[model samples]
Target: MKTFKVVVTDWEFENLQYEEAVLQDKRIELVKAQCRTEEEMIKVCRDADALINQYAPISKKVIDALENCKVITRYGVGVNTIDLEAAAYKGICVANVPDYCMDEVADHALALLLSWTRKVTLANAYIKEDKWDFKVTRPIYRLRGRTLGLVGFGKIPQSLAEKVKPLGLEVIAYDPYCPKETADEFGVLLVSLEALCEQADIISVHTPLTEGTKGMISKAQFDVMKEEALIINTSRGPVIDEEALIEALQNKKIAGAALDVVEEEPIRSDHPFLEMENVILTPHAAWYSEEAEKEMRSKAAMGVADVLLHQQYPKYLVNKEVKETTRLNESLDQERYALLTK
Candidate 1:
């Protein structure tokens, strides 16, 4: 038997070749399972020295049952699915591949924004339906000189800002932690969340789901936005309130929205967004591309190898506090494990 055991709790890829290749040490045995629940996670993960997680719930219960897990490396950047507090209590270092999909997600957000502003999809639908007229998408406004407000001025949004500025869009951001120098360099004005909502012609969300960020953009923000304003989200779904968004669209509170994520994964068939002609929806696919998939897999697997093999920290730690002795929620008091690692 191998001296150290690593398990892939779950994955979306067709095969684990990248993981296997990364964890090729003779003493490390890599296992794979489709664990869809806490019970399943506890069953196979108890014996694992490390885990390569993808969407599996590594909740408090599962963490309690983990006998030997030293690390849990996620395939994507978000660690909301895992209980960071619970894992920290058990000395498990939770890691994520934070930088792998920056380009893909930024590009996707830009695509959604451009598609909405240009009315590309609406025009295509009109022509394909044999209507053959521009009046259907009338009142489309010029993109130049319009303001684009980014909710979080993180790496992805920064990339997006760079891409949009060349097209004559002004970028303003609302990130309390963003350095003034960075904003000045990018020619972006850092404003309050409320101010951004009221001032932007187009609002794009790039925040992670946390206590503070969940439902951050709701009725109040919607109430303040211009009637022709559009919002786009490529970040976590719950960051924007689903019910409020539906109502906003129904009431024409905002001109439109383009979402790559929703409050619920695989939104129900009877979802109201489906009926709204102004909304553009995509299946939480902002972080995808053939190259991105492989890079994410390789980096995540290597994170596990770093812990179980090299006895080092994963380069991108979601919960870095695990490295120091626990102080009973002192660090988590305000942040509350929500801020995705920068």
Candidate 2:
């Protein structure tokens, strides 16, 4: 029996103990490589049957070289780093683990919201500096009876709404894809984007980063928000313009912002947002939990197995077109194709 070759980028391979169980299945061979540069990624993915990438840029140049690759699986939910159009053009199936850390992210967003509203970080800094009168510099607010606006009412936002409902928050959500009935099910009022901005006491983003969503919140949007409202972003960083957010915070246009992600990963040390008292920043850890990591790794490995064994389709396919192309190709057996199509 010929073994199928699977190449995983170094980042995903790191701390992935579940690969051992996968390697035990003799039909598949897992090869790990750390591709720091585009050239290295192209070279490593050249002959791979399936590639599992994490934070590696699969540009057009790299995808063009993968003639043997039938599928590309991301270890996490976000695919902003990968070029989806290029992958689609090459007929490569792109899969991601979209449901793994939904609750973790919602919890993290709530944590940030509470921390910012209560000035937890600021209070800690004040004590370290021997300033007992921190209350004079930074005041705290109660979470009860506040209007919480969710920019996108996806799974994370839905979970967040449920969690905060007990705290007496009036949740309003804006998501064109979600139905008004669904929002009503969660006791959340569905509102327009502009209305959400103007009426919300706290606004949190939970949408994906796509052409329509990129820079959706900019200077003009911020200008309409209430000066007392706080902003929280656990979603894609670029969805909200970082420059506009910084200016808003600097000029006291809004109360504060708690960001788990920024326009740039590993934000520069000299970034102006880092120096502001009204801004709270975290290093993209909103989706991180030990249990979530285990689930993500297990689900990602299963997705790879499903593709290679020509079994069922992945639960979360980034490119739906690839499934159609794969079905037409006759490379997968009739039974497998039938199962997928059905």
Candidate No. with top lDDT = 1
Lowest-lDDT window of 10 residues in candidate 1?
333-342
- Span of 10 residues, lowest total lDDT, candidate 2: 333-342
Candidates' lDDT values, in order?
0.87, 0.82
Q: Against the hidden true structure, what lDDT does model 2 obtain?
A: 0.82
lDDT (Cα, tens digit) per residue for candidate 1, span 92-139: 888898888999999999999989988999999888989988888877
Off by over 4 Å in 1: 325-342
The pairs that clash in candidate 1 are none
Clashes, model 2: 0
